[model samples]
Target: MDIKFESKEAERQYLKERLAAGFRIFAKYGFDEGPAGHISLRDPINPDAFWVVNPFGLHFALIKASDLILVDESGKVLEGGANRHLNLAAFMIHSAIHTARPDVNCAAHAHSLYGRTFCTLGKSLDITTQDSCAFYNDHVLYENFRGVVLDEEEGIAITQALGDKKAALLQNHGLLTTGGTVEETVFWFLSLDRCCHSQLLADAAAAGTGGATKKIGDKEAMDTWKVVGSRKGGHFAGRALFDLIEVETKGDYKN
Candidate 1:
């Protein structure tokens, strides 16, 4: 069947649904807390604009597709029923990525426990398992911790640190992932979160009874990416994930 969004309302609704899906998945994996953390998508036709972040202070479990605020690449609100202002750090962090990397249509960042733990250690996420392997040689490390990213300058610094990597571990902050599309970015974050969790578990096990060291070979890193990139899902999968999330959340992202 051919699905077409023939009207602006339809397109807005479609985008809203996709945004809602991102929220649900993040919530499902416990990547959010209170109002912290955010996910954003670039406007498909314009490189200088993007969807506004869902207002800060909302529960991830309650977000809906329609509650997403529309914003320009400069973080100015364009549409949606959300509160006028967004979280300062999110605007600084997300807007920078959107502006600097036109290739990245979707960007997500969160203070998930595992990701936060790894970020605090000042260590990169080593490619130890298949899950973490997708990020092998593909993550950037941002060591500048300038408190909360509250301005365009900090945002620019974050973007510079992101460079060409699809993922970045913000020192003393959290994890960030970007992609050519929302699906890809969301999946990257999901995978990154899992990878961090796995490493933590392994670390715990190693220190459990005896001082056993967990080591992953160089070849294992290459092997991990091989397994991950083998399958290409494209746009359909991202839209599907969004639609599924819309159904699950019942379109309740406001409050």
Candidate 2:
């Protein structure tokens, strides 16, 4: 299939809206902490580039649709429309994923509380509930904590760790999720965070007992996926996230 590039004006507008939608979703779910997480969309024209990412120091709740800073796959800032510096880790992580996975059009990374907790344990979430079933057959665990990823090679390693999985837990760090659309990618991130949160709550309720370790039957997991994943091929969940964000944030994701 041939990929088409949007007009410069259209690309900028589409990216602005999609990015704002992502930031709003993150904020609505309390996934961001003082600009600690990032999301990016692949440029419609450039296979080797993506739109401007959430810049360094911009709080998720306060990010505007027009504040995005365009960056290349090589981590160079092509346009800082908002006069902000790009987050190094955003470039490192997102650029690597976009380069390695041409099929993924959007990527999200965050250090949400529960996601970090699960990642620190280096364990994949079992298909223990409907919420966790989304990743029942696909997910990865990258346990090598190589400090902060300050270079492109580390980013490449992170992408390699992700492999074909839609989600990956960055050990000692947090979580990363990708998708064919910005909406899908944001939905996956939200699901991962919620799943981690649900698991944590279950563990707390179990009082550290084995109740937390109980796994959903494989058949049931498959059934749950059929219900959730097959719902317009996840377009429902993705759009729902977008709508929820708009409602929660008073229709103002762009500040």
Candidate 3:
């Protein structure tokens, strides 16, 4: 869909609102994980900078458009207040991604329960279900884990590992997903977590039965991805989720 804005401010507002909504929806679904996760969007007016959630203390559910912090490429807070700080790990990871991939307008990283568990196996999601097919040949597995990602070198390594992929499973860590829009990126994060949950359940069942689960062929999986993994599909899914959250929270996030 072609999004037309009356002015630059309107576009910036649209981006801010969506970024806030993404945080709230992630919190609603238990993706917050004790201030460990972050969702970031490229600044609408300044492509070299991005906006991210405040560091380490604020609850994701309570985040509003006005609560977001705008940061430059060097991880310096430019627009948000002095009390608001950006997480070093968030800066290391997201900055690398936004710098490396100009096409990625938004990047989401979270230590979700199932996603973390699935990452321990050092494997990508298999095409066991149609939903899993969304990641078929589209995700990467970052097999190296060098403790906490505090250094720029670690972040650059991750960026190289995630080259041109939509999602990445960080070994012994968690999941990272990127997209052209906040809605699409958030939806992919949600979908990836669900796929991880489904895969774990399937593996347990197959282990008990001593039988292998059926798999979809590469061609079929790729074809299904075209329909289910498109940015348009993700945007629609995210909008549906945002609508539900708006009703549940009574649009409090807009404040």
Compose the digit string of candidate 2's lDDT tens values, residues 78-124.
76455767788788888889888888888888889889987877787
lDDT comparing candidate 1 with the true structure: 0.75
lDDT of 3: 0.88
Model 2 TM-score on a 0 to 1 scale? 0.88
Candidate 3 Cα misplacement greater than 4 A, ranges: none
lDDT of 3 at 32: 79
Instruction: Give each model's whole-structure lDDT.
Output: 0.75, 0.78, 0.88
Ranking by lDDT: 3, 2, 1
Residues 85-187, model 1: lDDT tens digits? 6677777888888878877778899999989888888888866676676787788889989887788898899899889788999999999988876677787
TM-score on alpha carbons, each prediction: 0.86, 0.88, 0.96
User: Any idea how many clashes model 3 has?
Assistant: 0
Model 2 weakest 10-residue run by lDDT: 1-10
Colliding pairs, model 1? 52-69, 63-253, 64-253
